[model samples]
Target: MAATIRFLTARGVPVMAHVGLTPQAVNTFGGYRVQGLGDDAERIRRDAGAVTEAGAFSVVLEKVPEPLARAITAEIAIPTIGIGASPACDGQILVVDDVLGMFTEFRPKFVKRYAELGSEAEAAIGAYADDVRERRFPAAEHVYATASKAGDVA
Candidate 1:
């Protein structure tokens, strides 16, 4: 993360670090629960400090204890985007696919579904299959004879 930040900043790009309840740490967190994030808050504090020190322009806190998230955000010089962290944070982000309901089987607690893309796509595919089975497809322009009067080539 430090190396990536340095590389990006060198080229004038701003990088953001992610801390707390990181989905990559899902197994470690014992599955998508808000991190209690301890009273000492040392780990979160250190995380914020390191990201800022490493020259990241911002950091994100996801599903962390609200107080800890606020404290880290307050102490850190850069912005702290939050997801299920709290409104006190500088910004928020949501996964596009999740919000669009691409995966109806799973929905994160923080996301507000805007549409059922999964059902729509499934219905569309089902319709296409029905059309194919009913010989409703290949209307004129959709198919052509491979055979020619001169010869049938393989």
Candidate 2:
């Protein structure tokens, strides 16, 4: 991770480092849960230091204890972006689908839905399908005359 960050940042690419309860390592961590707890907090703190040392401008602190997040934020020179971590972070991020209620297969506890767009979309699609089935759509103004006609009836 640090190597990639160093390579990218050296090339003028701004990099954001991710640590604490990484989704890709969910299987290894025994599923999605809070990281940087108890003695492991120090490990997470060290990881954050390494990330910043690698030239990353920001680090994502995900599913970490609030105190640990605070410690890392204080220790690291770079900004900390939290997800499932608390207000101690410099910034916050959430999946767009989770925030908009578009993906509901499995809702995490941290996710706060701002709108039920999925249900709205389902209802709108149903209405559209019904309109098409009942021939309520494509009314007179929706169509145009054939090349053989000049504003005449079909």
Candidate 3:
């Protein structure tokens, strides 16, 4: 991972390192569970430091304990972006779908939904389906007249 970070940074490509509950490794982790707990905290800390040393401009501390995130943020030279980590981080982020409440499959403990757009969208789609079934959608205004029907021919 450090080699990859170095390779990207050396080529002037900005790298943002993500440690603790990396989503791509969800299967390896068994699930979207909190990381940096007990013995694993040291590993996360080391990973953050390694990325920073390898020239990562920022690192995302995801689904780790607040204290661990805070400690890593203080120890690392790069900015720490938090997701499910605490306010102690340099910045915070949440998935846009989660914020809009559009993803109903799974809700994480840290997600604070700002709107219930999914339900509203479902309701709107249902209304449209009803309109189609009642033949109300193709009202006269929706029909287009062809040029030949209007007596124009080339």
Candidate 4:
């Protein structure tokens, strides 16, 4: 916490430390499942306390028990950004692709699909290719000549 805060404060970037179901710990955490359930809640509380005490500007509690997350948020002076945690957080962030329906194989309930940029981009490229084949692009003055134009050599 202190180290995170110190670094962020010095660099002028907001701090967001992750705990509970951090992807880096996915194997130990048993996949991307929620954490802080059952007996683990207390441990989470302690961890959150330690983080807050250390002076972290903010924390990201991913895939944690909602109740425990809420409690941690209430206890901490700094903000908590819940990726898969709770609604009680100060703010939330989502990957544009996932929320926009780009990743259809996996989806979290909390994520709200914003757009379908994947499909949009694909269609745009297809249209551009078609235009190129039909000589729709590089019209007249759009391209340069190998040699100077009729009046250029003068």
Highest-lDDT candidate: 3
Ranking of predictions according to TM-score: 3, 2, 1, 4
Which model is ahead, 2 or 4, in terms of lDDT? Answer: 2
Worst 10-residue lDDT window for candidate 4 reads 1-10
Q: 131 in model 3: Cα distance from truth in Å?
A: 6.4
Candidate scoring better on TM-score of 3 and 4 = 3
Q: Per-residue CA lDDT of candidate 4, range 24-133, in tens?
A: 77889877777888999888888777777665678888878778888988998888888877687777767677777775668776667877666787788899999899
TM-score of every model versus the real structure:
0.74, 0.78, 0.83, 0.68
Clash totals for all candidate models = 0, 0, 0, 1
Q: Name model 4 segments beyond 4 Å from true.
A: 1-14, 121-154
Q: What TM-score, to 2 decimals, does candidate 3 have?
A: 0.83
Error of 2 at 137 (Å): 8.9
Candidate 2 stretches with Cα past 4 Å from truth are: 125-154
Per-candidate local distance difference test? 0.81, 0.90, 0.93, 0.77
Question: What is the per-residue lDDT of model 2 for residues 1-154, given as tens digits with 9 covering 90 to 100?
Answer: 8888999999999998999989999999888888888888888998899989999999999999889999889989999999989999999999998889986688887788998798888889999999899999877667765454666665
Clashing pairs in 2: none
Best by TM-score: 3
RMSDs, each prediction? 5.9, 5.4, 5.1, 5.9
Mind sharing the TM-score for model 2?
Answer: 0.78
In Å, residue 31's CA in model 1 sits off its true spot by: 2.2
